[model samples]
Target: MSRRWLSAVVGSLLALLLVPIAQAADTNLGDLSLSSSNWAEDSGNFPGIWDLTQGDMTISFTYDGNGLVDASGAHAWAELGVRSLHSGGFNFNPNSRYTYNTTTFDLRAEGSSTDVGDVTVSSDETNIYVKFVVNSGSNCTIARTRVQAGSSVSGFPRTWWGDAVPSRFNHQTIHSPQVIEYVYTISRSEVGDGDVYVAANAQIYCDTQRNPRSRIVRTCIDAWAGGVPFSRIGDTRYAIYDSSATRVDGSGVWFASDYDWTAGTFGPDPAGSPSLDIDDKFTISRFGGHAEGDYNLPQTPPDPWNNTHFWFDRDDVDQWQAAMWGMAPGVSYNTNGIYHVVITLHATSATAGTAYMTVNGASQGFYSNGWKDAEPEIYPAGMTFTGDMQQLQVFYGLLGYGATHSVTFSDITIGQ
Candidate 1:
């Protein structure tokens, strides 16, 4: 997809609409106790909100009489909703909502009045599972269920489910306490030490209809295994390169000529009265060139860098026929199994032209007249990374030479 479109998708995915809670004689289920048998209740209350924070914990709930019962005792319904959280990764956004990382179910016809239904959350080395169980003969049946595990919540009656469930069960009815159970599973990679939020609601078919919803039951999960270590490879100021395109100073910036496959200048200019200009930032003009960073050598097994963000200035789009600005992991480590590369740069194009952002040898047109975040992901067949090695590098190319076509860059970072 184009960089602009990709950025819009990212923004839309992180947008969350706030839900409104109806006023009622609600109850707070309080924090879930370590004891699974310790059930909470909201006696004579129609709606309620609950709160809990724990890992590998259990919580149970019961209403008027193990079901939503009005003075006339007509309605009997149950509803459950669960969501999780994730942050600091390639595709993960901290504000985005997630479904249960994992879930399972255990249904039984318990004879206890307070033990009508319960929700359990647990995790393993690689996955988290959430279990929901509704005992039989509680007079309350699971009229609806909502599980937001992926892009959308999946269950019967899609009309009643959105970013969150309705405040009460709908007119739909299920067998009275036939022992219902539901389980959901998600990768620990997707949750990364984030909290899981669960909410429940019930409704009684009284003459006027009274619905009650619980607060939230939050659960904690372990941290992600692949820890991300972010570090800047060079100083903020541009480093001067020698005749051989090697950093003459101590700066880690170096030129890479092995990738100059288009018969272009693969390093800092060597003859135009000052092939490369260095002030607070650096400039690249005319023939294509690649400035690479010097990372720690021999990253055995190749710990791949997942993300890199940088700032640049392109003032004249008509300077060249075909121009492209791109970044990649350095050319010292291997990039295997790295299927996707997303580049987000904060800058505006001077004018709409044939400019693109190249990633892993894949290119996508870039066009932005106003300053905005342009994000694009490149996916190619077979080996996604076709370079000699993987490290951090920023390069630009000009297919049809234009002496004035130059771009300035600064503050580049490579990490998770």
Candidate 2:
């Protein structure tokens, strides 16, 4: 028997034995971190995108079983009602539309001037808008949000109860499972001092789409999905661009209270999903920690940058992630001259990450792992993170260049 033949046989045996174990482990792992009973049915198919946000608390009931399941069969269509703990019973109809601000995620009454409260809702790189709520009170701040998802086809009403004392509503819906996300602000007094409870009211249609508005998402991430780095720029750092084959310092100016020199948003796409679309000016010669980019890298690498210089660790799995530095051509840094620009930091796998440059929306070079030796390799792996990652830091101001130069930035984002 040749050595090669013997090795192949051994490899085959290992695969047969280990593959099943791995598959079984995955099945045993079940859905993502969120509590399964909250949105999962006994049929093993999760058909809704039920999520909530309190303060630092975040919950994303991802559809784990399958992709794009219809609301007709084995699916759920229902309404979710959220109210302050102090308010008795259900505050509003789960299916009724209230006042919501997309830009700030503030929930209030449409006509009433009374202040409801503030609720910040944003999505991850995968485009899943996970609900994150924080309790500002000293007590545990226990509030109740009711959720009821299921259609008539699924039977009479398969309702789920929230944790604490919650109000009730009963309604019916057509067949199929329709996933929806609702953001609301609750009072600390209402919650008393306990955990927040959320569940479906009854298997009915909780129409959350009557008067819908898109949310303004920022790139404050803790995982390695695709997209740029920072979501906002502050007043400390300055952008450096290449003009006439020389590196020039770039400064930004504030237009209105809301508009910064660099406009738009930085981070993942507003529609969700991990991708990059850079239309701003700035430079992040470093990685990981804060720099000129809109966001910072994951914290796994411990230290991601070295004094405005991009750095990565080959031995450390977290440090070996990919990163990019992007600046709009005609606007930010390349106004005087055009050079190789990096607009994205992509991951190909768990062990490898790569960086790339572009010219005129075209590939300027192959992927480069700016770690040991700056070797050319494949992209790093994509990572998913939930919960409180880190506060997004936006650095704005002027750079100490010989000459005075200013640029405006917009649409800054991270994650894909």
Candidate 3:
């Protein structure tokens, strides 16, 4: 009623509005932390949980007690759709679904969403989907801001059920009362220090198979008491293995391509007559680079264990020479390496390519054999990459042919 009293009330409201809103603390939700009465309402069955930590992400499913299915344990799957999630603390559901097939533990992103980079998922436990987004793990400056929900067929979007029964799976089966968890991890770099929202969904299928006939059990978003806090990472989100000390643990030779290099061994050991000798090539002991084909020698070496050193014995080869040829399908010579002997390949086209070799990290320039018109006289047999290429390879060589006289190669890496 009075001007003075009205002004005082307005001032108090303004002060409250200006105060910063409190954020949730970071928490680890391992071993069914969501299967508690405190997480859900005092009366209802706990639904599922979507949790994010500094370097880990997870989705969990628990009985919410809405009583959608019986307790014999049906095959269940969980999905988390990005509605609005990023390092900036804003969520916008753009109808995108990041689906996790619980049984197979396969993670896929659909709905034309384009916010982050390639994401790979794997699982050791059946109930949970644990994954790591490779690009997000490597680059911290990049951020992942996604929405909580999407308009996709994968999660079976529903709208009828209310609070008592939010969503229901199409088919029902017997599932015991246990916490089913799906987990994934991204680099702190991908998560930065921001708020992210994931639209959570789960499915229950009969006959122990996952398909369209499966029922939709739950569809919702992740919520926390304090909210998931991403603590600031002072250093890089990922580790670097470039230096010798860092990569000294690395062992074995990396064959450029599986098609040319004989199985069980790398290219022919430094040959004197420039002829391929399958027996003289490097041995296949440890699993390092991706293998595309089988090897010539079937003998399996004892587990390489700490036998991490690669032996590249070129002393026997009076000369290093190669004939240029096009690369085979599903194969390319990756020119990313760091080492005492570095090989750089440039493909001008599908049929033509050139190569340059280096030793001790110095520029040996292109092969000394010289280029011949469109065809190169001496190109790496496995050379396949084209355009501004940088690879890492390390070489330790002794100049002899006896079993004792071989180049030891170890520590292979690609530039970031």
Candidate 4:
């Protein structure tokens, strides 16, 4: 007899003794779906699908249609597999096998069943927290976990904060059924009011080469503590006239003029003497002793033009006290509270000329002519002010009487 004919006769005899095979129907277990149709003998072309959908997460499985039968005719099997995917993607091989009984055949699921569990989010006044539970199953272990935060949900790493794997739980083996809690604190300055979105993921390794990730699960929390309110009282970048010494806002907070060096020897010059340049920068040209430009607080008294070189009166100490304590002119200044004063400028001098800035009586000299960003002078908690204070003063002068000196200031800002 022919080999094909003999094989067919053997298959017919076995079929007569075995129970009838039933048609494959779609099966649903929790969030997983095993979908297929029409069971038949090994045809070398059968394809099945296994789909898993959880909260905001979906995974697709592809069957390779390569079935293997036992040499002793005891069982037959096929595998539902996954293609290589990125982080926060899923991987698994759900083996569908049929074992022969005395008169019937049974199909069942076997092998690794790794998956991601519940992902929860919470927040307080100062921080936002996230937790991820990974069910690694008995055969596999978790390799890594990652978390990210953003303004919205759908855009992924584009809108997500902390970069591509921001908060990583790595370098350790997490066995079956363990929960990994990840907490990331986004400062109040980085987040705004309303909902804040977050996403979490976990990767599992079944063996040496098979490593698949769970689908990215995303959620949001309505946790946004309001940020510190800052009232800007001065900025040279806007609303300042090109050639005028005083600010256009009429606050009298910015002036480029000379201050009195000695009694009746040199007095405060006109507001236009060391006026603003065409670039809207405060410029102080060559001038006599104690030529200075200043950003003064509101209600400051006129220069006494005395030989003592004091800007504010010693008797009315409250004005001096407020300026030293980060009190901008119009805003309600916080005493010893957080405040920022930033300045950016450059200076040039001929012969022995010099340019320096004095803030709250502390002096920092500028050495280079290139644009420099003076470190933001911040007055944080627990600061005490003493002695005579020069609040944001820029002084330019020459050592030898006749040499020339020039100073330009820009981007001066005061906030509280």
* Cα lDDT of model 3 by residue, 126-188, tens digit: 122222232233221211212121122234333333111113432222224411332344332
TM-score of 4: 0.18
Top model number, lDDT: 4
The stretch of ten residues in a row with the least summed lDDT in candidate 4 is: 235-244
**Which whole-number lDDT from 0 to 100 does residue 344 have in model 1?**
24
Tens digits of lDDT, candidate 2, 1-416: 99999999999999998775432111111222111122332111122221122112111111111111222222221111111121111211111111211222322222222223333332221121213232233112113333221121122222232121113322122223322223433343322222222222211121123235854332111111111111233111111111111111211111010111222232223343323222222222222112323222332222222211221111111111223342233322222222222233332332122232232333321133343434223222112212111221112222212222222222222222
Candidate ordering by TM-score (highest first):
2, 3, 1, 4
lDDT of 4 by residue, 1-416 (tens): 99999999999999888977774442221111122222322111112221111111111121111111112212222211121111011111111111111111111111222223334454433444444433334233334445445454333342133223323422123334533333345443433334654444445433222335654333211111112111133110101001111111100011222211332211223443422111111111122111222212121113312111112211112344444432332222211111112222221111111222232222222212332233222211011111111111221111111112122222222211
List pairs with backbone clashes in candidate 4.
89-213
**What are the candidates' C-alpha RMSDs?**
30.1, 27.0, 27.3, 37.9
Task: Show where candidate 2 strays beyond 4 Å.
Answer: 1-194, 203-345, 349-353, 358-405, 408-416
- lDDT tens per residue, model 1, 34-88: 1111122111211222111211111112111111112221221111111111111
lDDT of 1 at 187: 66
TM-score of each: 0.19, 0.20, 0.19, 0.18
**Candidate 1 backbone clash number:** 27
C-alpha lDDT of all candidate models, in order: 0.24, 0.23, 0.23, 0.25
How far residue 197's Cα lies from its native spot in candidate 2, in Å, is: 2.8
Say which candidate scores most in TM-score.
2
